[model samples]
Target: MNAKKGNTKLVLLTVAILVLGSVFWVYASFSLLGPKDLGVEYTHEDYVNALEKTGIQIEYEGMTGEELEEYKLNAEKKSIHDYNFEFSDYEQKQFTLTAAESTALLNEIAPGFWWFDDLQVKVLPDGTMEGSSTADIKRLKEDLYSDVADDVPLPLPDSLNIYSKGRVSVVNNQLSGDPENFYLGAVQLPDKYLEEESVNTMEDYFPRIYTVVPGLEITSLTSNSNGEFVFDGVIPQKVSVTKK
Candidate 1:
C-alpha cells in the first residue's frame, strides 16, 4: 500500500477505537448511577402510600442498611433480625403478611373485581401458606361494568360456580428468603361444562392473572398434592424509580 493510504487507515482505526471506547464508557457510567440518579428518588414512604392505596396496610418490616448497622453497634444482644455480617452484602427487605394482606394483594392484581365469598389463609410454619377462596363467578360479575366485563373473552354466565384454593409461599422483596410461591387456585366445575371450547376458553379465561411488578418472573404453574395450581416465582421488586 502507498504511504499516504497506510497513514489514513491508521488514523481511522484510532478514531474508531476511541469512539467505541467512549460509547462503552458512557453506558457503564450510567449503569453505576444507582436508583437515585434516574431523576425522582423514591423513599420508603412512597411504597407505603402505594400499598395504602390498595386498601391494605402492608407494613414495611425490614430495616435499611444504615439502621441495621447502627443497631448492631448499640445493642447488647444479637438475634436473627440483628445479625451483622463480617463482609458487606445486599440488604433484603422482608414484609410479613397476614391473611387479609395476602387476600388484598391478590385481589389488587386480579382482573376486574373478583369478590371471594370466603377468603382464608393458613400460615405455614415456614412462612408459606395454604389459601382457599370460594368465588361465585355469576354473583361477582353481576355488577361489573360493560367495558370491564367485555375485556374478558367469555360471556358472564348468569349462574356459575367456581371453587378456588391453593398452597403458596409469600416472601418479601430484596430479601434472602424464598421467592413468592403463588399457587393459582384449583378450579372445580360441573361435568356438563366440560365440552371442548367451553373447557378451553374457561380454563384460559379463568386462570388468567398476571403480575405487573417490574423485575418479577413467574414460572409455569404445576398442580400440588390436592391438584391445585402452584407456581414458583420471585416476589416483585419493591424499589420504585421515577424520572424527574
Candidate 2:
C-alpha cells in the first residue's frame, strides 16, 4: 500500500511539474511575443516612405473627386477605387480636374519622364511630400533574379512518371520586395509561351505549402502514426513541439 501510494505521489508530482512548466511557458511566451503579434502601426512617415520608395508622387493639397480617387488607388496600393473627393478650388479656377484629369495633365507635362522608376514619392490628402529616391532599380533587378535563380527540387508526382520537378522558393513578398518580382508569377500562359522560360521548362506552377508560419524555415516533413504529415522547421524563435 505504501509503495502504491508513493508511486501515485510520484506521478502526481510529475504531472504537477509539467502543468506548472506549461503555465510558466505560456506566460513567458505572451510576455516575449505578444508585442510582435500586436502588429506594427504604420505612421504617416512610414506611409510616405513606402510610397516614395515605389516611385509615386505626393499631392497633399486639395484635389477633385477624380484626382482624389487616383491618389487613393496609389496610397492604398489597390487598383480599385470606391470613393470620391471634390476640390474646393475646382469651381473658382478653370483647372477643375479630377484625379484622372490631373494624371492626364501630368502625363502630357511629363511624357517619357520615367521618373517613377527610381523615385520614392508620396501624395498625402492635403498634398504633403515625404520620400527618398535611393532605390537602385538595376541592383534591385540583379538581386531579384539572383535569388530566383537559386532553385529547389521537388520529387515528380509518382503516377504521371514525370521525371523531375524544380521550383524557386519565394524569397521576397509584395510587402517587402519589388512588386514586379511577385507579379512575374502571374504571367498568363499565352504571355509565358511568348517569352522564353529562363529557369525550367516545367509549367511554372506556384508552390502551395501546407503551413504559412512567417519566418519558418521548413527543412523536412513526415507522416506520423495518426496519418498526419508533421512539418519540421526552425522557427525564428525556437518553438517546441510537444504531444498533448
Candidate 3:
C-alpha cells in the first residue's frame, strides 16, 4: 500500500510540472517575449519618401565616424526656437501616409530610445491602430523610480512586450486618443492603469505639427481601410529640416 501511494504521488507531481510548463510556454509565445513582426517592410526609398513628407532634411554627407555622431548629438540639443523656419507658397493640402511609411517615420524619430526595440504600428481596416514594442524593464524601472516616491512599489520583469490598441483623432491640430487595450507581455492592464492622463493620448508622442509647419491647421485626420492615414491641413508651407 505504501509503495503504491508513492508511485501515485510521483506521477501526479510529474503531471503538474508538465502542465505548468505548457502554460508558461503559451504565455511567452503570445506575450511580448521578443520583437513582433508587423508584416510591413520598409526600404531606403520608403524612408526617404517618409522623411521628405516630414519636411525635415538631415545633412550628414562627407562626415563619418565620430564626426557624424557629434553632428547628430548637437542637433539633438536644438530646440524649436533654434530652428529657422522659412515659409513660401503657403497653402492647405492633403497628405497621406501608408503603414510602411508611418512605421519608418516612427522608428526614425525614436530609434532605440528608452531601450525600446522593434517598434511598429499597424492600422486595421476598421481604423483601429495597434502598436507593439519590446522594452527593457530594468531601464524603465530606473527611470520611473527616479521620479516617483520611494515607497512606490514597481514589480516589473526584466523586460516586457508592450502593446496598445486604439483609435486616433486630430482636432485643432492636436492628436489625441485613448487606448482601448494596453498590455504588458501577455497580461492586459486594467482600465484604471490606462486612464492616467499621461498614457491616454498620442500628443506626447508627436511634436506639434504647427510648430514644424507654421500657420498649420489640421482640419481632419483619419485612417482608411487600406491602412493609410489621411490628413487635411493648411500650412504656410512645407517646412524643411536642415542641418545648420
How high is each candidate's TM-score?
Answer: 0.29, 0.18, 0.60
Error of 1 at 51 (Å): 15
Candidate 2: 10-residue stretch with minimal lDDT: 157-166
After TM-score superposition, the amount by which residue 103's alpha carbon in candidate 1 deviates from its true location, in angstroms, is 8.1
Q: How many collisions between residues are there in candidate 2?
A: 15
Candidate 2 C-alpha lDDT tens digits along 151-208: 5243211111001111122323111111111111112123343334532332232221
Ranking the candidates on TM-score from highest down gives 3, 1, 2
Write one digit per residue (lDDT tens) for candidate 1, span 1-244. Answer: 6999999999999999999988765444322211111122233444344355333221113443355334434433112213221212212223333344444445332212334423444344443435444444444444333335656654533332232222333232221112232222222344444445544454443333332233444443333343223434544333322112
RMSD after Cα superposition, model 1 = 22.9
Worst 10 residues of 1 by lDDT: 31-40
lDDT of each: 0.37, 0.29, 0.63
Q: Cα lDDT for residue 116, model 1?
A: 44
After superposition, the stretches of candidate 1 with alpha carbons farther than 4 Å from their true spots are 1-114, 120-161, 164-190, 212-216, 223-230, 239-244
Q: Best candidate per TM-score, number?
A: 3
Q: Candidate 3, TM-score vs. the true structure?
A: 0.60
Ranking of all candidate structures by their lDDT, best first: 3, 1, 2
RMSD of each: 22.9, 23.4, 6.9
Query: How does model 2 score by TM-score?
Result: 0.18
